[model samples]
Target: MSELTCFKAYDIRGKLGTELDTSIAYRIGCAYAQVINPTKVVVGEDVRATSNEIKNAFAQGLMDMGVDVLDIGLCGTEEIYFATKFLGISGGAMITASHNPIDYNGLKLVREDSKPVSNDTGLLDIKLSAEKNDFTFADVKGTMSVVDTTKEYIEHLIGYVAIDTLKPMRIVVNGGNGAAAPTLDRLEVAFKQKNIPIEFIKMNHEPDSTFPNGIPNPLLHEQQAVTGDQVKAHKADLGIAWDGDFDRCFLWDSDGRFIEGYYIVGLLAEAFLLKNPGASIIHDPRLLWNTIDIVEQNGGKAIQSQTGHAYIKEIMRKEDAVYGGEMSAHHYFKDFAYCDSGMIPWLLVVDLLSRRSTDLQTLVSKRMTAYPSPGEINRKVADADVAIVAVRAKFEADSIAIDTTDGVSLSFEQWRFNLRKSNTEPVVRLNLETRGDAVLMQAKTDEILAILDAHA
Candidate 1:
């Protein structure tokens, strides 16, 4: 058996046909069943053109191992997580490449109760078993069944916000030709059924596997313009966009100004703390000061964890945190079995907007001005470690505090920045925040880039 390159640190991903194909996906399914040895498993797929073929092949492999498969067709990654926990299933897998390009695909796996399977957990074992490609068949093959959890999932989402309290606000939603369109449609119908007067100005609101408007990654500046334009053209109250699998959602204010994910973290922390004061909120180390201030000001505890969904979820469960957020737009909720959701964050934000009777700009602008951040900037270098070490060495003498939690974080009296290597890509990411000094932020960002450039 040949080695498979699709296995990654947290999940399985690779270019289609070359690095991954139906055969490899089948082997992975068989290997997962062999390693976990579960009686039943759930499966889901995104809107990619090849997803159905890959998912069907994987399910066949599981069935050959006597593992009954509950096929939840055409859904996001979080849906699989929800079904795994809600249905009392032993395991689940979602076939998606997330924000990756059109030519790529992968699988995100979880065990019982929707617990993630990272490299340190069960992914490596699954990879090794798949590489061996030798498995014993069960006495009897298991059966396959189809199930739809759309209504239940929508109901669960509506539970987050009071229907009557939602004002008749016009909001723009850009699905970007991904899986979010279907889910958004379902939510819209549910709101109407409940007599909610919210109006949805839909844009690119269809599941086109071809990605006619390009991929749904709103993180890129180019991909953000369409949503911003729509928001402005419709003169909507707010704007929201999602990735291909709809696991992460981005926001725009009433003026069509993009809100950095860092501020959204602070906003969400405040929202949760309003209801449950003294609760714990988990955040990543990349961008800290804003989140720390918001969490502390609300009489809540702020805990910093390493980046990545697996780490955040684990820390949230341990600390019993009400919420956890990453600057990269991933948000986790304790009520959602410690798993991250794209749907829940937007729902909670809309609720906050309605309850406050304030526009999105007013809700977050103060926090943004108090703690200005350059969001996350990325630089490609020959060696990320060398660049990180150089930055730490140069700043250690003047830094008030230094932390190596996930990367190198140096804090001074007024400002701080974190330099870390991207886990899934070959680049170094930098995040800097200052105490109401945009000039100082830009100057320091330039200095750090010079150091990184020297290494490059």
Candidate 2:
């Protein structure tokens, strides 16, 4: 028995072979069964080359412990979240690297009701058990069943929008050869059957385990141009891209400009508030000015939680929030068991555009001007905590206010910024936005960069 490095801050993720392998996966399965003690659990795998092999090992480990496994093969992380709650299972797990490099892979686990088992909640206990690697087979081993929930999942997604109100529009979706291609195909069929006037122009839409077109991350500056160019080339109203597991989706406007997720958070917060007035909307501490402003203006309450899916979901359930959003493009819905979904965000955006009869750029241009942010800027530092402390010391004296929710957020008269260390990586991230001054936002961003560069 030995410690496992695959266990991370919120999930199981590590480089293959050295840090993680089939044996570690099996140990994790055993640990999950021992800790959760569920009669039945849902398991899923993404399109990564080794995902299925690792998933099988994990499932067998569970079966050995007398825990039945429902295997949803070749699916995104959100599918595991959905199946856990939808099937009323005891737990759920997914095998995916999720925008990590091709050589890397990992697992995401949740207990009953699709609640995330993160570090503080239950991951540490699970890690300790897995490291023990002491297990005895049950008198009667459990069974494994192959399941497909694509159609049902699609139905649930479509229910978010009224088919009758959909206007004719063209959308460019760059799947990046990940897990979303099949779901996109199914959604196309559903829309056609319902006579919805929407056309999808897909780019790199097939599930290529090799990821020939790169890892499909729209957040990368270099990758952003790929989707934007396609949007312009196809003259599509919107461009959408997803990571390896499709848990987060990024968007670009008709003018081929990538809209930061911060603005989309505001847009979705307003969208949900339009339907459910006086609802509480959950947002992360990083880049929340836009979200809070929008939520307050729409008769909604914007509550800030520490960043990360587990914390966001916990606060969402605590406050009974209708929606939660992170500037990193993760959007959660109260209706979806308080789980985040990449598919849902784009759906709601499309529906909002159709009903409002406005173009994508026009819909968000005002917010973009009102609060201009450069999205998240991550810098590798020798020590994350030291870097944050140094930056805080340099700016705190001049700051009007300070917040330490997930990271250090300092407020000024016209602009504010958040500096935090990443939970999963050895990097310090910075996010800043201005009330209405884009130039000040840029200048301050540069100033912060200089400080970080010197201190970090």
Candidate 3:
């Protein structure tokens, strides 16, 4: 069997025409049918230009294998997860490359009950089968049906926040000209039907496959001003933006200042603890002092896992976590089949505003001061392993404790940092945080960068 470069550690993603095309997509669909062997599978596509053709070819492959296809047209990734469980389907696949460049595309696959299909969980098998391309068509071809799960998804999201607890507030929403607008529009209608007094001022709300306003990748922090300026201009209480598929969201405070995803993890952890005391909360190893403090003070438990969706979701299932937040802006919920949702986080955050009657900055500023972090910084090196080893050697002598759970995390009396290599690149990521010391955090961050530079 030949190797497929499109198959990645978590999902199938690659450049559009070269690494992934209609032919490869067909093979992948047939392979998925062969490996998963599901009778009925749910399929959906984002707003990418190539998504429709690729999804159709994929559906044909499933049909040839006698697996019925239920198509949910034009949706975000979480919709696939929701439909997979909501419709009682055997499996589901979403055609999206969430936050990837304009010319890239890929698929996020999940099996029954919305469990992820990653490297160890049947993705590699699917990749190998696709490479072989030896599957046969069944005697009776499967049929295709278009389904609507919007109402069900909206109702489920509404279940997370109480309407009476909501206060009159204005919010700025930037759809990133991707797939988030449709869902947001529907949610506005639902909120109106329920008489919720929240006003939504939308930016880049229209869906455009060309991505005229650039891709909706709020995590990159490049377009933070686009949403932040609007929030301040409109005098809105909060600002929210989503990536292409609306799976991960980024936040901004009232003064239009960007709030790092690291702090959002802590904020969300505290929110979950306030409602469900002593609930297990899952967090990534990077930039987690704030999260730990919040969980502990609020009478909850904090569990750290590797920094990836598959890793976090597996731990969510194992621990039955009430909520899980990553520094990369991914938030997972037990109520949503342990899947991450971009929409749920904002709803809960706004609900927090209503309950506390305070602004976003006021809520996060104290935690931001108590445990200052510069967020994750990436450094490209000739050899990532050498760089990591070099840094560990320099810090281990003075470190009070060290952790290699996912990476080398060295803790001092006042400051701590986690240095880990990237899965898809020859780069090392540094996440450093200090206990109520922003100046020391910056100094340590600069020191680590200098060491990484020397090693490079």
RMSD per model, one decimal = 1.0, 1.2, 1.0
Q: How much does candidate 2 score in TM-score?
A: 0.98
Instruction: Please write out the lDDT profile of model 1 over residues 1-456, one tens digit for every residue.
Output: 778889988999999999889999999989999998988999999999999989988898899999999999999999998999899999999999988999999999999999999888799999999999999888899899998887788889899887888877888998888888888888889888999887889988888989998888999898788889889999998999999998899999989899999999998999999999999999999997989999999999999999999999999999999999999999999988899999999888898988998889997899888889888999988889888889898898999998999888999998999999977666899999999998999999999999998887
lDDT of 3 by residue, 144-224 (tens): 999999999999999878799899889899999889999999999999999999899999999899999898888666699
| Candidates ranked by TM-score | 3, 1, 2
TM-scores for all predictions = 0.98, 0.98, 0.98
Q: Model 1 residue 379 lDDT?
A: 92
lDDT of 3: 0.92
Q: Please give the lDDT score at residue 114 for candidate 1.
A: 95
Model 2 misplaced regions, further than 4 Å: 424-426
lDDT of 1: 0.91
lDDT of each: 0.91, 0.91, 0.92
lDDT of 2 by residue, 99-216 (tens): 8899999999999999999888789988998898888778889999998888889999999997899899899998999999989999999999999898999999999999999987
Candidate 3, pairs of clashing residues: none
Which 10-residue window of candidate 2 scores lowest in summed lDDT? 447-456
Between prediction 1 and prediction 3, the one with superior lDDT is 3
